[model samples]
Target: MSQMTSQTHAIAPEDADRAVIYGFVGRLLQAPPSAGDMDVLRALTADETEMGLALKSLSEAAQSANVNSLKDEYNALFIGLGRGELVPYGSFYLTGFLNEKPLAELRADMGVLGIARADTVKEPEDHIAALLQCMEGLITGAFGEPATLPIQEKFFTCHIASWAPHFFKDLTAQNTSAFYAAVGALGGVLVALETEAFGMAG
Candidate 1:
């Protein structure tokens, strides 16, 4: 990751573009291996932007790991017997239930933005992947409109800010985490960055 400086400047919403990139990087940080993992990893590692480059470095470092290992790590973190050691679901984090207040709230917000949970997902819409996908959707204009800074902040604060940092902290300290430790580091840093950046906006 490029060293972020403490230079002072105008607080225009455009100044938040870096945070958007960081948010995308945070998504990539926690992404498990997919069919195109190599290609995606290469793209991110070779990316010119700071977040992309950071992701790329982590990706490269994690290259020796096979997809099955990544899957096992993911399962250990998120899908243990009946429940994982660290539940990555917003509803569970917020309401202490699998699909409760937090999920309802996120569903309402997603509906307003025209995002629906995938039919294939058995989990609630508050899964970390789902929320990260929402962020991606906002960035890519998937909800028929681009998300304004305030919109992004609201979504992030309401959903991600509530618990993701703690989750990543757990991931970082997990006994089974190895390559994912890098992911946890990236996530922890981004959460701190986002928390401070959003505070600046407020």
Candidate 2:
């Protein structure tokens, strides 16, 4: 996981909320949730909003989740013997292959934005979790000063908007999914909400 720097600038409440959700989903996708993580999920509250309902479902899923079972599910769904049920990389989603142009493009953008993959991380930089965490950092000034809305919109449009929604849709549809289905549902809603909000900003 990326170790983001301390926040230097104050983020707007809405942007802070966005950062929290992005961070939450990014962390969840990176690995199976630990018992403590499950406890956090189970404590989540919900309202009638679409995002809230997704949260409610996730909370329910977490309440019933077994740690060992979740580990198996995570392995089956994301990391299998040869390959998992899904390839959670942006390049594969965009190009039907890994280490393609999409990843190169993302790396180039990362250079420009002062984002760098940690030396400890073995996975490619284009993993969905990495990209989402990058966005969270941008929103919260973890990379530097918080990125402006236009900057955020540009990154989202170029990197996430094109493929993440479809990826989440696929995740939700997977037979191997149990706790992850709720994750996918929440991810879908978040991407949709971000897309719409960015559109309005544009």
Measured by TM-score, the strongest candidate is 2
Cα deviation of 119, candidate 1, in Å? 2.2
Q: Sum up the clashes in candidate 1.
A: 1
lDDT of 1: 0.67
When summed lDDT is taken over every stretch of 10 residues in candidate 2, the lowest stretch is 1-10
CA lDDT of each prediction against the hidden true structure: 0.67, 0.92
lDDT score, candidate 2, position 166: 92
Go through the candidates in order and give the clash count of each.
1, 0
What is the per-residue lDDT of model 2 for residues 1-202, given as tens digits with 9 covering 90 to 100? 5547776788789999999999999999999999899989999998989999999999998888898999999999888999999999999999999999999999999999988888799999888999899999999999999999999999999999999999999998887867999999999999999999999878
Question: For each candidate, what TM-score against the reference?
Answer: 0.75, 0.98
- Lowest summed lDDT across 10 adjacent residues in model 1 is found at 1-10
